[model samples]
Target: MTSSVPVLMYHYISRWKNPIAVSPELFEEHCAAMARNGWRGIGLDDAENFFIQGKPLPDKSILITFDDGFLDNYVYAYPILEKYGHKGTIFAVTGKIEPAAAPRNTLKQVWNNECSADALPRVDQPYVKHELGFDERQDPFLNWEEARLMEKSGVMRVSCHSAWHKSVFISPEYDGFYQPEKRTRTFDRIDSDIIWGLPRFKALPRLANRAFIPSQRLLAAIRELVPQETDAAYAFFAEEANLERLKTLVQGFSKDELGSYEDSMSLQGALRQELSQAKTTIEEELGRPERSLCWPWGAFSPDALSIGKDLGFRCFFTTEMGPNPAGCASRIHRFKAKDKPASWMMMRLQIYSRPWLAKLYSSIRL
Candidate 1:
């Protein structure tokens, strides 16, 4: 039987030596190391062929997948991959792809800034621009041209990660969970879409499948909460407290603003629409159809998995750390990059490559 390959996951490729991001210099070093070591990068199709046909993969075969499609991928990683002539798969959040630049440090903005843990102004407020390294107004993500160029190079592949990068299908049951840091901003935008925007959007009237929802209803619910009404402030605070209590239902999960059931379900629908368009456009541009996709944030419900299946995707990848197990429903495993490449990956890969090690790790982890 053909063994599964190590699917290396990466996020930002920049000069910054941060925890989640690796400097461009280091990224070059890592890729060079792989190439020098005789590892060959494989595209999704190649990997699937190895699984389906039991065909032998090249020595050191690896799949390079980048999550959240950072601008740096275009700015930095692209040149390096081109240098090595290796292909990569970029799973991008379609909705978060701004026309120009958006604020970076998104994880920081949402987790630390919004929580008031950091001195920085909350991302939601129209506070005058604070300095981040990149251009403020420009979308912090890659533009259409960059993505197109990468696709044209034949060394990079792009896949859907949902328009909004929110979870779906598994949401109704787990209400009040994860949310974006500029969550208020997103909620406002969605409100605009439902309220003033949808009525004017031609498709809203035509899509018989879309369930009509007024922005005002959501607006009203938010207002009924404590901050909006001071007279009922005491009662409202209690209600808010109750909402917080409901978060624990999703076992082993801490609720983020995006984790809210309403947000999940609504964003899922919004994402599906965006994904449909993206898939069509991408296929047209690439001159071929893609049968594989990666989950946005690696969060999906059984229903979401089923949706992808219905959409005709042959396989889906997940960020869940480890190697892809044979006969494991095609929910392949992936690993993320740290500021430095650690022994963690080497050890895990060894374990995954060997069935005995995998059994040991699974027993310990699961």
Candidate 2:
């Protein structure tokens, strides 16, 4: 029987209690358990060969991946992996990674006795808070220097997540109003400068949605209608009656003033530009060919997949849960790493590594 590999996906290794965040302490526990149980972490090259060419991988072989390339990965996850002799890949948003003057503190320094564990950077600090508006928020991503350091260490590899990791307005249908309290995704089509109180439209991740661009006149008219005071704007949008009024106003706009969706060709070109830029930027910066891509929010279209292949992405990771057997590179399945104990995680790894068990489990759960 051909052996299957389990790809475990993670986002933030932080103290933050979110769906995507696993605490650093628990992450170390997971790594320690993997090493203790004789499981070896494999890289993308090995994964590609095993999945694409039916090449055999070592017993108990697994692929570990982190999405978004958060600074917390360097601060917490990297040292733990190094300690456990495991390899992982970070699918980074190329646009978020900026150049840094020098490398920031990481758990490596504490592990080497150069600094106390308490002195290491924390994810909850003001500078790294993601809740703040984009311009007001300090970058929470791994800088180029940090990424390079990790790549040079042989324990981590950087791949493409996307250029912007943004979502675009898919329809002009107003869903709500954009308030800081309601902002979930890090990037969006709306301008950052126009913070708070913009019309929230139906949106999907950039690669997944054909962008709906409103005419300048329509946008200007809407902005003119918005209350200038922040509290008033929030109160105005909060009323269901106001929403109906806004909808009526929007409905009054001519077809030309409302907006237009990106044509098929235009969407393809945009996808190409966004993805190619990421591929090229990562290659140029890291000095290696980036052949792996993890779609942002695990949202991608047929056009996205086709464009990704043309740009040389060989392995495409999705959020779907399943066992990855030989010859499944285009639709690689991954199970999310949750905030759980090492034993719990290892049990999942066991199930995912076996095709039959994984199928049965997924079926029963679904």
Candidate 3:
């Protein structure tokens, strides 16, 4: 049996309160406690050696990672790691740090750089700019200056989370959650896409296999919900690719044609483009190996993994909680630590990071 090495994940390191937002004071305490106990914090290579190569990590060894590249990471997490003589990895949303730099953008924010990463912006979960609502914009992300400084200082190594960290797949509707925050923003640019997107998108053929969705009726309901989509988009449906594409499923289509199948397909290209660009940008900017990819939203499809692997990304990280044994690179499991005492964190980690213990705990969690 292989040793179960624990990889800890954290999001925000700020005073501002939200789920998964760990405060600076508590973060520092956690790091300091680990340091005092002679725990060794290792890098991505160390984990790869243990999990992929079947080599052993040092006893009391741990790997710490931060997701979404929030400025609070630079402002607080970076400094803490440095103070304790430990190192961690940051899987960043390269696009949120600089919106205009990417080739493709799903959402545009009048990015405010004047604010520092430590200022505690009012950002909530799913911290990427493209996934966020326009009104949720805040100045809580790290700029190049800060990220470069940390990279130079050797406190943390940077890797790509996504170019935009966009939630391209695993939409709310797909999972049957229907949460607004989890709604797909793929067609967000087009007014009609946003005005009447979800109900119409629900009619896509791929999703039809999951459950019995009344496609014609759902399209009809969208017409009533936003009559303008019907009036504006209806006339072109007969001649457009959308009608032909949707005709394979849900025949007798008496509802407003969902605008442009081309538009929806275009969104997928944006996701792949972001994945590729994030690798390129990180390599160009930080001079680090863009070999690792932590899936944004912990969302991965066979297609997503194939795309990343094709691009030379060998190490994959995900939010799926459990101990991953050797040779589990493509679906490496990680769990987040809360804003609690170091002992509290360690206890939770012991329960979740060990395979048998995690299974036992999961069985009794209810």
> For residues 1-366, could you state the per-residue lDDT of candidate 2 as single tens digits?
348899999988988767778998999999999989988788778888888888999879999999987888888988889889999989999988867648888888987889997877656432333333232334377889889988898888889999888877777676655553433445544412243445566777888888887666666766777675666666676788876776777778876566778788888888998899999999999898878899988999999999999889888999888888998889898989999999998999899999999878877876
Clashes of each: 22, 1, 1
Per-candidate local distance difference test: 0.54, 0.81, 0.62
Model 3 ranges with Cα > 4 A deviation: 99-135, 168-256, 260-271, 362-366
Candidate 1 has what TM-score?
Answer: 0.62
Worst 10 residues of 1 by lDDT: 197-206
Q: What is the C-alpha RMSD of each candidate to the true structure, in Å?
A: 11.2, 3.7, 9.3
Better by TM-score, candidate 2 or 1 = 2
Q: What is the Cα-based lDDT of residue 130 in candidate 3?
A: 34
- Candidate 3 lDDT over 1-366, as tens digits, reads 336767788988877676778988898889888888776578777777776677876666778899988766765677678778888988887877753231221011112454444443343333344333322234456666666766777778878887765322222132221113323332132112233323433422221112122344545654453334433443334344654433433333333342223344554554467678989998888766778888877876665677788888888898877766667787777777898889987686566557788666645753
Higher-lDDT candidate of 2 and 3: 2
lDDT of 1 by residue, 293-364 (tens): 677557565655666666666667787765564444467777666666534444544566554665567567
In candidate 2, list every pair of residues with a backbone clash: 51-327
Best by lDDT: 2
